[model samples]
Target chain A: MNILIKITYDGTNFHGFQLQPDERTVEGELNKGLAKTLNKEVKIFYAGRTDRGVHALGQYANFYSDTTIDIGNLPKVINFNLPEDVSVVDAKYVPEDFHARYDARLKKYRYVVHLSRYRNALLLNKAYEYPYKVDPDRMRKALSYLIGEHDFNSFMGKGAVVKDSIRTIDKIDVIEEGDFLYLDFVAKSFLKNMIRIVTGTALEIGRGQREIEYMKEALKMKKRKAAGPTAPACGLYLVDVKY
Target chain B: MNILIKITYDGTNFHGFQLQPDERTVEGELNKGLAKTLNKEVKIFYAGRTDRGVHALGQYANFYSDTTIDIGNLPKVINFNLPEDVSVVDAKYVPEDFHARYDARLKKYRYVVHLSRYRNALLLNKAYEYPYKVDPDRMRKALSYLIGEHDFNSFMGKGAVVKDSIRTIDKIDVIEEGDFLYLDFVAKSFLKNMIRIVTGTALEIGRGQREIEYMKEALKMKKRKAAGPTAPACGLYLVDVKY
Candidate 1:
């Protein structure tokens, strides 16, 4: 039987969501925590892999288990064994054929930027600290170019192995709350380092370092060097994965 | 001439606010950054030292320099040269006798707790992750005992070296916003781990683990064991320093 879990985690302590040899990763910790709870080694599957220092709110995972432990107690058991930064928000039985990754229809991500003059100690790792004064209207104009499907070859990082660079972006919205700015993107799929690159390019436009039309040119050029630098991973969050 | 800087730093990557050997500390980083900017050795005077993983909003520091660098560009120069996690919010000239630590009249601190069933991946290191449900009204009632003047030795953590534990708490407020709980306290002075201990005790009362009146007894006892466990350092932030 397959068990699905709706989870959230602070990814700062882990290398990323994927398992790596001799390194602490979210999946490795989750597997260890599940094994301790069920008294058996279990392999878990994730909907997607978040990079190191990237967090998730509604991350989905699945694992096969034949143990008799009550599903209701799974959250408590896993939370007790897991570190304070990782938590299983909910767990339930799923069909054996249910897939966490390939079956997903859409994914939503949010990147937060603290725009205030003062740096918040409490928000250090969770938010991108950009003290530069920004023009939101200019940023919004740059974001409009990213709302539809594009080749995205210009935004791809150097080490990405994926051959297909075409992806669709459902929507891209930039909203401000008090001193913080939130950039939300909904998409069926994203190229490697795509969101970070988009954010960096948009920030440059907002800072008056680049024009909004640069985004259109970058997409048409389909060259990696045409886009801005990739933003840091700390400010990004995997908000939700819909199936 | 001496330049006093009222700065804010996100301490996520720092050992603490104090200078320490063989560690990436806020003071050490600030000193190095200042030296790099001014092309001379610089020493900074801080209001107080913060623990590892702790944050500061209005931390004050002062440095002496003979260079005629424009004061108007100090923030830009220091910010451009400093690490991304550290920033200079404001800078000004101060009298020779104006001390960052000794001349401060009051300090304000805030501790944040996440009370929702769903953990916030972005706030993992910035706030306390409490899975149990909390009663805000009960927590507020318990905090009333901490207001006004009191001998807060009971709330001081073990290994605190202080000759006197008497302190005047100007105000203590418990605020609930969505699933987040914030405890704000203003005091003339605090003993070691005083705020954390108070927050832990208030959490105990809020969770129905203890009675509110127990706080009164704990204050009178002047014993560290009488209070609740010290809350983690990650959730605490020094918000302001008044002169």
Candidate 2:
């Protein structure tokens, strides 16, 4: 039977979501944990391939195994052995044809920024510390240019080999909660580091480092150098995946 | 001149607030950082001597230093040398008569509990994970029994050395936000682990593990053995100190 599982992790300790031969990764640990619980080898597929130090609140994955373990007990047994920074939030049996990666309809990403002089001790590595104050009005103006479907090649990550660079952004919002800025991006999918690159563009405009027109120019040029630098990985979180 | 400073810290890495020759402590790092920046030996008197793994959001301290370092630059210079988990929130010059401990009027502590089956990756050591659903109504009722002045010997930590066990509790509030519960305690002074012990008693009563009258019985008994266990240190935070 095919199984679907939701997970949450800190991601600071792991290399990334994908399995690596030497370094510890989220997929490696999940595979090891499921294999031990099922008493056999198991291969899993994930919806999002998050990068290193990128946290996740609602990451989804799937696996196949023939076992007698109850759906409720599967996560319990697996979580008991998983590392402290990672956990299986939920686990259940899906239809035989259900696929975690292919069936995903929407994925939500949240990038947090700390806008303060001294960094918050409790939020170290949990947010990207943007030293200067950012104007929300300016940031929103820059964000407006990136909304809707477009070829985001200028925002695509360097060295990411892909056939298509076109992707649709369903929604983009910039919210301020105290000294923290919550940048939410919802889309069917994203090119590698697309959120961070887009955020960097907005941040630059918000702080008067770059004009608002730069975003439109970058979108039109479709050149990597036309966009702002990619923001740090620590501030990014794969908040949810809709199937 | 005497310098007053407000600080915040994630206490998971330190032994405690007090200094120890062989162990790493918050006070030790502060002194080291201050001395290095001031170009001389330095000492500090803090408002709270929090236990190991106990966090602090607004801790107060004072020190005597005669240097060219301006009052405005004290926090900046000192904070730059301190460890990543500790930070100085503010610094200013205070009268020589001002004392951090003796002149303090109140101290507030906050204990956080994440009541869920799945642990939050970001709040590992920052919050207590209580799996069972706790009735807040019952907890509040039990908390009502703890308000006002009382000899909290029953709730005092083990190996506490003190001349008096009497302490006045200004207020006790239990607030629930989402899946997390915030237990706020305000008092003039506390016998070590008093908040944790009181919280443990309330938790037991809320969960139906112990009778509501157990709290009063423990207070009347005036013995540590009569009270519930002291909750873990990780969940407690020294929230604020007011003079």
Best by TM-score: 2
Clashing pairs in 2: none
The segments of candidate 1 whose C-alpha lies over 4 angstroms from its true place after superposition are A9-16, A19-25, A28-43, A79-87, A114-131, A149-153, A156-166, A220-226, B8-43, B51-53, B72-87, B116-125, B158-163, B221-226
> What RMSD does each model have against the real structure?
3.8, 1.5
User: Every prediction's TM-score for the first chain?
Assistant: 0.96, 0.97
Distance (Å) between predicted and true CA of B102, model 1?
A: 3.9
lDDT of each: 0.85, 0.89
Tens digits of per-residue lDDT for model 2, A1-243: 999989989988989999999999999998888888888888888897999899998899988888888887777778887888888878888999898889999999999999976766777778997878889889998899888999999999988989999999999989999888999999999998999999998999999999989999999999889999999999999999998
Candidate 1: Cα lDDT at A149: 78
- List interface RMSDs for the candidates, in order: 3.7, 1.5
Clashes of 1: 0
